[model samples]
Target: MKILFLDQSGKPGGAELCLIDIAKPYRDRALVGLFADGPFKTLLQQNQISVEVLTTQSIQVKKSSSFLQGLKSLRQIIPLIIKVVKRAKGYDLIYANTQKALVIGAIASFFARRPLVYHLHDILSKEHFSQTNRRIAINLANYFASLVIANSQASQTAFVQAGGRANITTVVYNGFEPKIYQTCESDVRQLQQELGLIGKFVIGHFSRLAPWKGQHILIDALAKCPQQVTVILVGDALFGEQDYVQQLHRQVTALGLKNRVNFLGFRADVPQLMAACDLVAHTSTFAEPFGRVIVEAMLCGTPVVATKAGGAMELIEPGINGFLVQPGDFQELAQVITTCLHERHKTATMAHNARKIASQHFDVKIINQQISQLLSSKFN
Candidate 1:
């Protein structure tokens, strides 16, 4: 079936990366209509996915935007909406990959008379989104979306709690190609040596540097960790979170952790970096809709410790496959890190279990089949 996928990001976030896998199966018949042009567009091109920059203008609405601000942005995006409506008519279904996409896709779907699927990636809660944004998202999905593909049970639950239709929402975890994460020993050693992490117990944190992402929490926990423990932060700030990025640098300095911390910025070699690390940490201060990094780490056969909330709780069973710590608990996180450091054999076993489970459940082929079945059943 012909499908039109809409995303608003100019950079590759978890949701945008997930969209790449979802669109791959329908590459010949699908078009990824991006609201802005940047690295994500380039990534689509590299993947051989049909993509187009639908609008040159930016959507300035933030998750905490006021209703007036949203309306102003909506006015600016009218032309984009018209453009999407014209394009939507040529597709069997319109799949919205982000919130801003949902806003435009909802209106376009109504005007174009096409079924719309809203992929819910974020937890629609007060911690993550403003009440106005949550209301807009839920109302739009309820009224215009034929189906809502939530990234996790946490995301699905938050939508229903915010008055979304439960019947319309279903959980679908982000998929990854397990083989992509299997780095050769020589490559892992080379990466470790290149990063000057040789003989250090390396910890990797792979998310955009944001306050809610809790990069500072990791830094704080790092200060308490053994001197042999080192951290490599793998992502850069995507939004206007430069201030938070600066704050993290200052925190690392004040805590005297400059030598132990490495800001690698945004690199395309995520799987290699993950495989080189001895442990991965997901230290989000708030409830994450889905911990994509956690699954990626698992697929890389690296032991992980994630904040114990939201979808993280679904992915990890403490001491079984991986470990979990309470959100924002630096002491708990530090302790977990120390435990993993001292008990290498135990963590290694857990990592093996994690890789096996992740390979079985979150493989890209399996996830794409699930999505295809859902789309076929709903839109056929």
Candidate 2:
């Protein structure tokens, strides 16, 4: 079936990466319309996916945008909305990959008389979104979307708690290919040597540097851990969070972790970096809709310690496959790291179990099959 997918990101976030997996099966018959152009567009081109930049302008609306800011962005997006509507008429369905995309896709679906599918990637809660934004998202999905595909049970639950239609929403975890994370042993050693982490216990944190992402929390935890522990942050700031990045640097210096922390800003070699790490930490202060890094660490056969909330709770069973710590608790996080450092054999066993479970449960083929069935049963 022909599909038109819409997304509003210019960078590759967890949701954008998930969109790539979802759009791959429909590549031959799909057109991905992006609201802005950047490395994500280049990524689509590299994958041979049909993509076009619908607009060069940025949408000023944010998750915490006030009502006035939302109104202003509405005017800015009118031309883009018209374009999406025109393109939607040629497809069987309009799939929205992000919240801003949903706003335009929902309207386009109504105008073009096509079914709308919204992939809900964020929890619609006060922690992540303003009340105005939450209401707008739920109302739009309820009125215009034919199906709401939530990335986790936490995201779906938040939607329902915010008065969304429970019948229309379903949980679908992000999927990955296990083979992609299996880096060659030589490459992993080279990476570790290049980063000066040869004998150190490397702890990797792979998310954009943001306040809610809890980079500072990891730095705090690092201070309490053994000196052999080192953290390599793999992502850079996006969405005007540069101040937070500066704050993290200051925090690391003030805590005298300057030699132990390495800020390796956005790199293309994620799997290799993950493989070089002895442990991966997901320290988001907020309730993450889905913890992509946690699953990625598992697929890479690296032990993980994630904040115990949102989708993280679903992905990890403490001491079974991986470990969990309470959100924002630096003491608890440090204890988990210390435990993994001391219990080498037990940690390796859990990593083995994590890889096996993640390989089977979150395979991309299985996830795509589920999406296809949902579409066929609902649209066909």
Candidate 3:
């Protein structure tokens, strides 16, 4: 079946990365469209997926107190929407990879006479989005979406609670190409040297540097961790969170963790970095729709400690596969880290169990087949 996949993000986050898996199996018949060009475009090309950059599609759905300003931006986007609607005519279905994608793809679907499948990755609540944004999302989803594919059951529940149709929604976890993410031994050694972590135990925070990601909380936990342990933050700012990023840096310095903390900006080598780290930390201050890093770490045979947020409970078995602490609780996180470090004999066993979990349910091959079956029977 011919499918048109749309994503309005410019940066390559976990959602964008998993989107590569979603489109990979359909590479022969699908068109993967991006709002703008970035590393995600490069990834799609590397996977042999047909990619097109619709430069006029903007990621910034303008959020302002003034309704007039918002209308102005929408007016500016009218020509772009017309272009997308025209392009969607050849597709059998429109797969929206994100919320912004849904906004555009749903409109395109109406114009193109196609079904729109919205891939919902975020929890739509007053806590997660602004009041106006939440209302807009609910109205749009109810009016235009044919199906909603949530990243986790928690996200699915949130969508329905926010007035999204429950019957038309399904939860599909993110999948990983394990082979592509495997790290070479030489690269691990080089990474260790580069981070000055020759003899230190590294705890990695692998996600975008947004305020809700809890980078500052990780630093607080690190302040109480053993001296031999170091925190390695792996990601770049993907939104208007530059002030939060600067605040994190200031807090790290104020807490006297300059030597113990290292910011390794956005790296395409996540699996490699996961291999080099002693432990993975998913320290989001709020609920995450899904913890892709946790699954990726588990697939790489690494143990993780995550906040007991949206999908963390689903991914972590708590003291079996990994640990889960309350979001923003530095003391609890510190205690868990200490327990993990002290119990080195059990780390490998936990990692082994983690891989078993990944293989059983989170493998890309298995997930792609499931998606294809669903699309064929329903969407086709």
TM-score of every model? 0.98, 0.99, 0.94
**In candidate 1, residue 43 scores what lDDT?**
94
Candidate 1 TM-score over all chains jointly: 0.98
Clashes of each: 0, 0, 0
lDDT of each: 0.94, 0.94, 0.83
lDDT, candidate 1, at 55: 88
lDDT of 1 by residue, 141-213 (tens): 9999999999999999999999999999999899999889888989889989999999999999999898889
Which stretches of model 2 miss by more than 4 angstroms?
none
Candidate rank order under TM-score: 2, 1, 3
Flag clash pairs in model 1. Answer: none
Q: What's the lDDT of the predicted structure labeled candidate 2?
A: 0.94
**Model 2 RMSD in angstroms:** 0.8
